[model samples]
Target: MVREHQYEAARFLWGEGAIERMGEVLAAAGVDRAMVVCGEHVGANEELMDSVENALGDRHVHTYTGARGDTPLGTVETGVETFEQHDADGLVSVGGGSASDTAKAISVFAAEEGRTLHEMKTQTTDDGESHIPDLPAPKTPVFAVSTTLSAAEVSNIFGVTDEKAGDKVVILDEKIRPRVCVYDPAATATTPASTIASTGMNALDHAVEILYSDGHAENPFYQATAEKAIDLLVTNLPAAVNDRDPEALAAAQLGAGLSGFGIVGGISINHGINHPLCARHPVSHGDGNSILLPHGIRFTYDAVPERMARLAGALGVEVEGGKATDEATLEAMCDVVRELQEEIGVPYRLRDVGVDRDDFEAMAEIAAHDSAMANNPKRVTASDIVALLEAAW
Candidate 1:
């Protein structure tokens, strides 16, 4: 059992044009000589760069524009090299999960001055014990400008891909959490609707998994926040996707941020299943979650029916009976999630995406041993994981 967990409470700023205030916040935090880590799209936009330069004003800025999905280890080294070349004192990550994750990895490497990237990578044992190094010195701070609902901006931990092993590596350190996060709906305007919709599902996965997490029940604060995050995400995701309303977009961003707050409590089978699916296939993280969520909920619902009922209520599903059986309530919640995915045009079945049937057994084996699976509300075996993958297919 986990006890006395800590939450990363970064200073959050949100609004329509909130990103324009980056210069003011940076100056107040006494940060100068900052390195900007961005995605290929944002990195190439001269207009966006102008805005960034305008915000930084006279502060020294270095740009590293090589972030990609699944934060590659080489990208982290590149970001560190850029930071050192510019003598950067801080970082500004401008994109979604990949960009923010790269910045976090850079900070981790920066702290251990002489350590190689491979040496700094986290190592996990068969028993799930992780050997993470300690950073006694204050590390460089990161300021995030979020352009998607992925919510990596608020996390203390980030995932990087190990090219040699062909697997994802997760790193944890509170010092990697961003010092300031700017959530401007306008910034996400240039992002594709499909990407936004898919990432929203990823954020939804965070909230739902936290609600059913074994560790979350230990913290009433996390419970309440998870519920609120669920409500906001369910109501706003479709609006943000279909209408493209700035207000709805802002609300979705806030919902993503709130969902991240409870993530330290834990994740569940949905994430466990999706991580391996994404790793094996080219599927986006959110799309994989969107596909596997209903199946994951059904697998765990029998163990925690009352909580499933509460979650169904939060999603505004109309329960047929006030005293509906746990099984009925569980089915209802799963249906609601499926309906939302369909409405938002996200893939609801693994087959609808490019997931290969031949890979089900292999994916399940990997998912069974994933680090996130430890927090699942119900005990899961390799057989159970394979069954879920088959059902999703």
Candidate 2:
């Protein structure tokens, strides 16, 4: 067993009634100026914004509504400008992962030294990596009011696609984690059913991958948390996707947080293969994972059969008997995932989402080298990734 202990950031308030407690944490953290982030496309929930404003009394409260989908360099700069223009002391993120990720990038850029944004881009880090770090020092605290079930709050990690570089970059550090995660299920009322389903599926992949990850045996706490998260998401996500009921939404958000926390700590091959899908194709983050998850599970069956069996049960597939062969268990589990994707309207094949064979080799090559690939349960080769892509195709 390989054990490399890791610490996840954020003080969280999960479940119902958590949103009301945001003021206390904000006050305690000494956030004198708070800027709440939202996407320009996000419908203004004035009442909720007003409530947040009222909660942080005697402090400057502002709305930042420029975050758009796709984390290109342009959007990153816009987010950074929003922070510095406001001279914000506290960052409160609203909307989904795009907005949340944008907020984190803004904080990163704002903390950097005297290098202008233009100079920063041309100058990669000393390690020959792209993008300049927040080299000067730390910036203000980040607080997230997550309306969607996709957990972007607890993790210090943020995923952005460098359009110019033609790849998605996941930045990690303790500073990027939200100081507090305010989960208001009511805030999710307006999210499209499609978005909910895709993101929920992504969360499921996170939890499941971690369960079959490298250090699971040596890290009981991480493995246990991941197991529970998978259980909760599989139990609640379908209802949350189908209906907008407040209770169901709350349950889904809670499950998402659990799963998000799990994957943020450790992930595997599905994302290694799926990231390229999102980068090159016009697929939602969750749908990208949904398309690849079953195949990933199939790939790992020989290595982690028992855990795969449990996933099968959580996904509502009958195992016939616990004594069944691992291959049989794996087939049953993949079938369960396939059926759920069909039921929830997530596309199970890349063809259904309009991906063609023209760039299959290119995509596979990038996936095999992706940082996520290194943490996979089973060591993967470019050919293995190509095979999975062909299966999905």
TM-score of each: 0.91, 0.87
Q: Candidate 1, after superposition: displacement of residue 210 in Å?
A: 0.5
As a TM-score, model 2 comes out at 0.87
User: Model 1 misses residue 46 by how many Å?
Assistant: 3.1
Model 2 C-alpha lDDT versus the unseen true structure: 0.71
For each candidate, what is the lDDT? 0.79, 0.71
lDDT of 1: 0.79
Error at 61, model 1, angstroms:
1.7
Error of 1 at 112 (Å): 3.1
Alpha carbon lDDT at 91, candidate 2: 82
Give the range where candidate 2 is weakest over 10 consecutive residues by summed lDDT: 121-130
Candidate 1 lDDT over residue span 65-184, tens digit each: 989887877888888888888898888999888899999888888777786654554443356443565656578989899889998898887877766654565666788799999887
- In candidate 1 the C-alpha lDDT for residue 374 amounts to 69
TM-score of model number 1: 0.91
Residues 121-233, candidate 2: write the lDDT tens digits.
31223232234344446767888878766676667767767665555656655677888887765567667888888888888888778777663534677666667776777
CA lDDT of 241 in candidate 1?
95
